[model samples]
Target chain A: MEIIKTSNLKKSYMLGNVEVKALNGVDTSIEQGEFVAIMGPSGCGKSTFLNLTGMLDTPTSGEIYLEGKDVTNMNSNMRAEYRLKYMGFVFQFFNLFNELTVMENVMFPMMLNKRSNYKERAKELLNLVGLGDRLNHLPSELSGGQQQRVTIARSLANDPKILLADEPTGNLDTASSIEIIELFRKLNQEQGQTIVMVTHSPEIGGMTDRIIHFRDGTIEH
Target chain B: MSSVFFYARKDAKKNWKMFVFVIMAIAISTANIIIINGFMDGLTDGFLEKTMDTSSGHINIYPNEQDKYIEGLGIKEKKLDGLDGVVAYSPRITAGGTLHYKEKFKTIKILALDPSKENEVTILLSKIDSGKTLAANDRDGILISYRLADDLKVKIGDEATIVFENGKIRVFKIRGILHTGLAMDTNTIIINFEDASEQLNLFNKASIILVKLQDGTLSGQYKNKISGELGIQKIKEWEQEIESVLSSFKTFRDISNFMNAIGLFTGAVSVGIVLYINILHRRRQIGILKAIGMKDSQVLFVYILQAVFLGIIGILIGDALGYAGTKYLEAHPFPDPTLGSLGPRFHLSLIYDASLVTMLIIILAAAIPALMASRTNIIKAIWGE
Candidate 1:
């Protein structure tokens, strides 16, 4: 079943009197539980597409349907609510709070929702990411791959239906990149976690269920 | 809200150096306010006590006719002798006189009291700094204030000649020195009642009556009680007679309030700069928080709570320091060259006022930066623009 759809999505901004079209007239859809990759060169608007789909930025003109519900015109607060309820995100920098311990960082999103059993759930998620023993350590004490794993654990804290990642392997070495990809593949195959990843590497794109390539702010084929 | 506090605590701990800097700034400002106000209150209290002891007493009875003596003092004394709140009373003859010590001449108020009965209503005898008090039989012994001695370069046992308004001159030995801390002491002299009556040509007549009341008795209440029997216009409470001193003290307090306002402004500006810098440093983190479904209000609340927490901790520490400093001053007062020891006094109302003012300044400091953070462009922040 189609879990996400966007019709004629466009995003534009003015940079000191020049209108820059970041995304223009894009149509796309993704099935539920599919591990999809979005690929393009620099300045081709792949990141813009991910931001719109993740509900982090507004589109200039479009309709976005998540599980058959049109959510294109939702206000910022409603978009935040939707993101909390159904979407999760991972970034290249692994933005874990440096001051908090590993467990506390994982527990942050759940803390916002005021969920019960957060301590136990956070520990459980840390263990699931194979970082249970490092729960008391700060993010500064972890390696790059370990920090990314912790970021993944944090993203899953609210039990979101879809996980969006932008350049997840961009900042990692080859070994860490492979480990992260394997982890994503395992989550998709075993738990049926829907994921849409933006990447520059063809090898990473080839591992996904399908690839959506883009150029000049629209789907290229 | 819980998440706001939780994140606020995290951020505070992470950036503790900056938090400590802001806290110390606020704490020092608050401490200055407390100390300055407390010291001023102590000075005012000391001045009032000295005025009551040396001149005004709790109540002063003046003559209805300024040029005449208080009529029927014997009858009034007999009526007031057994009054419940009237601890002691003394009749005094006050006359303006010119004093000559060597070549220096100054105008002075001559207060003549029966030394045997005057100690009951005034603290002059106990406050004698150099010589003994006048005895009942001592013919022409006089007590001059310390400030008067300093001005005339006279010492105890020196002979100072006084010329009364009636042009009668008498040379009297300075038997003692008085220091009462009130400004009136600087230009006043005390002489024996017999000598005053002989020199001023008064026959058994007194100019004013000083009355001491019992502890916890309000002088206004006693003044009201006696105003009807005596002439209403002639009865005056100590407060009524010390208007100039009271006004000067009020002016001092107003100046202190102005200094406190400056302290508060300085504290607020320092705190605001620190908070703004901290928000600037955490712009990306704030963006990430917004991206992950945190509302703008929630994000703003986190920074505000952080600032409030720092302010509260600072105020608690400052109050503790202020209390200890004032108590220490009370125990070991600062010794003045002329006025003996001076100490600081603590007023609880001042603490409440200072705390309220500090809290307001802190909130203003925190809110300006928090508003800026809330209105930050999320995309620009996330992309490090």
Candidate 2:
């Protein structure tokens, strides 16, 4: 089943008096439980497409349907609600709160939802990411790959349906990048966790079930 | 709401340096207000007490409008003995005189009182700083104000000749020197009533009468009563007699009160700057919160609660420091020439007023910046675009 769909999506921005068209008339869909990679060179609108689908930014025009529900016109608060319950996000910087311990950071999103068994769930997610021993440490104490794993654990705290990642391993060393990709591959294959990722490396794209290549603002065949 | 408090506590606990800076600012501001206000109150109160002790007798009676002296004082004294709430009463003749000592001439107010009756009515008789009180039989002795003696370079054992209003000159021994810290201290003299009657030849007469009441607050009531009963037209309460002087004290007191406003402003600014810098440092954290489905109002409430916590803690510490400062002054009073020693006084209402206003101002101060933080662009902040 198609879990995410966008039709003729377009986004624009004005720098000075000139309008920059980041995305123009793009149509795409990702199936449920599919590990899809969006690959392109810089400034090809790959990040913009991810942002539009992840509810990080609203499109200037066109419709986005998540599980057959049109979400293109959702207000900011409704968008946040959808993000919290149905979608999760991972960024290149692994934006874990530096002040919180690894366990606390994982428990944070669950805390916002006022979940009763959040503590136990957070610990389970951390153990799944293989960072149970590092729960009490801060993010700064961890290596790049370890911190990314914690971010992954935190993203799963609310049991989101689709995980959206932007350059997940872009900041990691070669060994760390491979380990992170393997973690995603494991989550997708074993747990059937649907994910949409934007990456610059062809090697990371090769591991995914399918790769959607883009040039300028449109998908390239 | 629970999450708001949860995050607020995190700020106080994790970012303690900012909290400390804001709290100290509030403490110092509160301390300054308390000290200045307490000092002003003390000066006013001290001067009031001195006036009642050395000058006004809580109620003063003058002659009828048509007469120079109240006729039949013997009858009035008998009626006063039966009056309710009358502690004591003394009839005095305030006369003008000129003094001669070592060829330096100065005009002075000669206040004549019955030695035994005066002793019952006022403390000036016993407040002799350097010598003894007037004796019942010592007819040729006088009491000079200590400040007057200072001006004239005279001592208790010396003699000064006074020319009375009737032009009768007499050389009297200075039996005592009085320091009551009033205008009387520098320009007045006290003489026996009988001597003044003999010198002035005003037999059975007085210029005014000073009446001591059980409570000074009832002076106006008794003044009306005295006016009706004794038919004295010009009777005045102690409050009326000291109106001009007390206004001066209040003017000074009012000026000092301006500091309370400045103190509160300083508190507002301190908390404002702290929250401003704090919001700047935590922009990404705030953006992350917003991006993760936290409502804008929830985000604003989180910072507001942090500011309120700071206000409450700062108010507590400030009250303690201010109270301690005032109490220390009470223990060691500042000396003055007019009112002897003055001590600062603390009012519990000051804490209530300061806390209410300080809390309100700090909340407002914090809201401006916290609102800015809550409204930050999530994508820009998180991605640093």
Candidate 3:
């Protein structure tokens, strides 16, 4: 089943007087339970495409369908609701709220959705991420890889349909990167979670079910 | 909703030290508004009370509009004695006279009242700076104002001669020095009502009757009663007679208001700048929250709730501080040369007004930054773009 689809997506911005096209005329789809990697060199539209698919940024001109429902023209409020309900995001920097404890950070998405049993759910997610002992520690008190694990635990808080990651392990060392990818592979193979990850590393891309390589502003043929 | 409150509470708790500066700023300004207003009220009320105590006693009954003196005083006095709410009343025979000492003399307004009755009507005898009030049998004894005595260079024992307006001359010993804080203190003389009546050949006549009411607030009611009973058309309440004096107090209030307004403005600006900087520092965090599904209104609400929390806590502390300061002033009044010992009175209405206004100002101050924070573009704020 097609969990995500986009057609002729375009995005542009202006720096000084010149226009910079970030994404140009991309057509793509991801099946449910598919572990896909968007691979590219620096400055490619892979990250932009993921952002567009996640509803973080609107395309200059495009249509996006999530689980066969058109979401391209949704307003910010509706997009926020969709983001909370249908998607989770992991960024390069493991953007955990520094002020929140590890447990509170995981509980944030559940709280946003007003889900019941959020505290227990957060503890369960934290233990699954293997950071059960670090629940009360602040993000700054944790290590780089541990913070990324917290972010991953938080992303799973609402049990999103699609986990969108933009270089989820880009800041980690090789050993931590391998551990993070192993966790992603476990979530994908065991739970049949759909994931669309953006990264530049070919090794990580090769580990996924399929890789969509990109160059300038669109996918390479 | 709960998200807004949770975030607001957590943010304040996590960075309470940063918010302390903002709260203290609000508190100090609130305290100043209360203290300044209290001081101004005290000064104005004290001066006005002194003026009223030395002159009018809540209500004053002047002579009939057509007569120089309210003739037939015996009947008027009897009616005044039976009037309800009348604590005391004094009849004064006002006469223009010229005082003469050895070397100098000045024209003065003479208020001749029975000293015993005058004491009850006003704080007259108690204001004597030195010497003693006249005994009922102490003939030829009169009290002179301290300013008048200074001008004439006369002591309490010295004798002063006065030429009555009716061409009668009498020499009286200065029995007491009056220190009443009014213009009357400069050139007024207090003589026995009998002596002035005899000298002017106006027996059973008085220019005005001053009536002291049990409650000062009942002046208008008592004035109407006195007018209706006595058929005196020239009666006035102290408020009606002191328009000019009250204008001076209005000026004091206006100045106090202007000063405190500036103080509040500064406080508001401080709150604004601090919140703005705080928003800027947390821009990335705000963006992350938005990216994670926090709506724009929730973001706005979080900051606004923070402001409300700050306002409530700050205003509470400020009210306590201002209340303490006012009570301290009341307990230990500071002295003023013109108004005697001055103390600020604590009125709940004043504190309520100050707290409510301060809360409004602080909330508005925080809104600008909160709006900016809420509407920030997610990608740009997160990326520092």
- The numbered model that scores best in lDDT is 3
Per-residue CA lDDT of model 3 for B146-179, tens digit only, reads 8899999999889999999988999999999988
Residue A83 of model 2 has an lDDT of 84
TM-score of each: 0.88, 0.85, 0.92
TM-score of chain A of each: 0.98, 0.98, 0.98
Extract clashing residue pairs from model 2.
Answer: none
Candidate 2 lDDT over B1-385, as tens digits, reads 6656767787668888868989988888777777777888777777777777766787899998899887788888887888999989888888899888988867889988887777667776877888888886778988998778888888888989999987999999999988787778878889888888789887778888889988879987898898888878899888888787789877787787677778888898988888888888888788778766677777888888888998888888888888999989989988866667878877887667667777888899899988987788888878776
Roughly what TM-score does model 3 have, to 2 decimal places? 0.92
The 0-to-1 C-alpha lDDT of every candidate, in the order given, reads 0.85, 0.86, 0.88
DockQ score for candidate 3 = 0.67
DockQ of each: 0.59, 0.46, 0.67
- Overlapping backbone residue pairs in candidate 1 total 0
Give one digit per residue, the lDDT tens place, for model 3 in A5-116.
9888899988899989988888888999999999888888888899899998999998999999999999999999988888999999888888889999999889999998
Candidate 1 DockQ category? medium
Better of 1 and 3 by TM-score: 3
lDDT-wise, the better of 1 and 3 is 3
